[model samples]
Target: MKKIKVMHIIGRLPVGGAENLLLTIVRNTDRNRFNLIVCCLDKEGQIAEKIRQGGIKLVCLGTTRVRHSYRKIRRLVELLRHEQIDIVHTHLYKADFWGRLVSLLYGVPVICKTEHGDVNSFKNKPFYFKAAEYLCFNKILDRLSDGIIFISEAQKKEFEGKRIKMKNSFLIHNGLDTKRFSSSNKRRSQDRSEKLSKNNIVIGVVARLSDRQKGQSCLLLAMRKIIERYPEAGLLVIGSGEDEGRLRDLSAQLGLDGSVSFLGVRDDIPELLAGMDILVQPSVSEPLGVSILEAMYSGLPVVATNVGGIPEIVRHGETGFLVPPKEPDALADSIIKLIDDPAMAREMGEKGRETVMSGFTGDIYTKTLEDLYVSLLKRKCRNRNYRYADLFEIT
Candidate 1:
């Protein structure tokens, strides 16, 4: 009756959906049933610190900018063997490759991978370098792991079409902590009031400033149109990345200085979401967006691009408006409609909160994950016993 040791591996413990999901798993999983360990491939980011603060063991592989180091792989294998890891669950691409390979080398029984994004979208890459990286990682994913977990059914179907022979692929949507996200928190409410004065309508976007994928430029263009009409409407952007400087310049060039506020790499997401009247996710490409769920749980209506698994979350007319990716004009129109009609926005936000409470709560996500782990472990045992019987017959 010993507890199983589950190790989660990821590329980097950055402030992203994958990292947040891992953090929730570590925090919520029954400690009596499973001992959790985190293995981050690169340098630890803010989320890594949060995991450690929660009293979990975190091991960083210390991989520099270089890719595919066999020495680090061997070291990881040794760590797994010494820890007697019962299950190796990997997130993102690099971790999926190296973690599964090392787990197999260490004779770890259960290996599972979570596909947080669609691999097919790599085809849309304009640069040869990006396309090459995708091709290389796609092969690595096929070669590693026993089971695949996707954040959305859209992601699963994309993988299937690519001829990836995963025997067990399951769809488990991302979840949020509804209580933590609720607007009742005194601190969040106070902060919201301070940031957004009573009369101002705040439209916010929370994402890393990555021009290639996040489509921040498209959002800026959309904001130009929004400001042309509702000059009082303010925009608050949270999070920072490589594209911050360029995005800032673009905002100024579009004469959005006073109206647009860039609050980079914020830790106060719940407070920020609570302050917002509408949440916008203008991603050229995205998987299952946890931010959308968080906004919904915070009772904020969303306006997002109709890409990847976005349609799965945002019911076009019900929860929020879904515009085509890279369409700044369409995005502008949607935002204007919602801003003009406050009552409609409030109704949509209420419905969104209901959807999140019923389906996307963190408790439900963790329970579903636990069930999946137990089922996979049982199947592994059954397969092993059958293999033993076959060996005996041969002997």
Candidate 2:
């Protein structure tokens, strides 16, 4: 049988959960069963180059912004037609819009869109304005898409309640490469201590320094209290974004210069996670966090804000601790409690690793996706046969 050709479209192939998910799918899927190509709407990131290095074809439309790019859309349609793409799976808002539009124009058989975050989260004015152009275009994209993929049940509920006319919606949680994370054991404890210092009980957070969604300021405030109680407690923030300066200023204002280290855009995430006794994700909003799973697989206890699908992964007292969003005191208390009790922290970390090994492995994720693909293809074929029968007046 001829292999199915899938072209994945994304706004940008950055070091993010959605982008990482696309990479996992491309890398793990059976090459004999599917031919995969990546189509990025904007300039490619480091992750895109990694995809290219893996012998996968990547195409960028060179769109600087999402505003009324008809020329870019036309070029994309031409590329899809020329490449004979069978399926166009889009991620993020801009690619979801333009990718679906061009896929329809090029007569692609399968059109799928994955919702990485709750679209309703943009109902607030500031965030909506920040992403206004994409928000304006999403209605048309939602209508054009054949299947809508959600990373979590919360994401599906939020989008479905928003009255998006989705033809098919499915919840597919993000998966981690449990074996690789567990087996690598590449964490250099001495190097980590050199970076974090031996005197401090390091609490690490791996996220883009975005204030709107990531709530980094809240984490910093919590860290302020944490350091006051345990003077040796320190925070190691990884990843960089627009809010870095403000967060740094907030730390300095809190007199946490010596206690907090901002390691921007780190390449050693697994090692960083391994070095920490606890991991924190204080996101005000999140669809589902792949970082949580990665941390868990690295045997680090997690303390995350209770928001959007985090509860689904971190069972309150079992796997990790969950605290209310934007509550610095609660966040601080949870971290302190976990930090003070090494045995409890170790137990939680072990349970978290078990959860990932059992449910969140790359093999399981790829299998589930492949099964969904097969099922959708069969359904499409059945519908096509029905249409053919109706047209020909044959049974």
**TM-score for model 1?**
0.89
Put down candidate 2 lDDT per residue, 321-365, tens digits, no spaces.
999998999999998887676677777878888888888877788
Q: Model 1, poorest ten-residue lDDT window?
A: 386-395
Go through the candidates in order and give each one's C-alpha lDDT.
0.79, 0.78
TM-score result, candidate 2: 0.89
User: For model 1, how many clashes?
Assistant: 0
Question: Could you say which candidate leads in lDDT?
Answer: 1
Q: In candidate 1, what are the lDDT values of residues 1-395, reduced to their tens digit?
A: 56777899998977887888888788788777778999988899989888998889999988824344777877798788788777899987667667776777677878898887677554443364355465665455455556788888777787778765566788888878554554473334334333333447789898878887889889889998998888788899888888999999999999999988999887778877866888999998888788899888777779999988888889999999999999999999999888777777777877887888888788888889888887777676677763322221110
Q: Tell me the spans in candidate 2 whose CA falls farther than 4 Å from its real position.
A: 64-68, 121-137, 164-167, 179-200, 386-395
Residue 393, model 1: Cα distance from true site in angstroms: 28
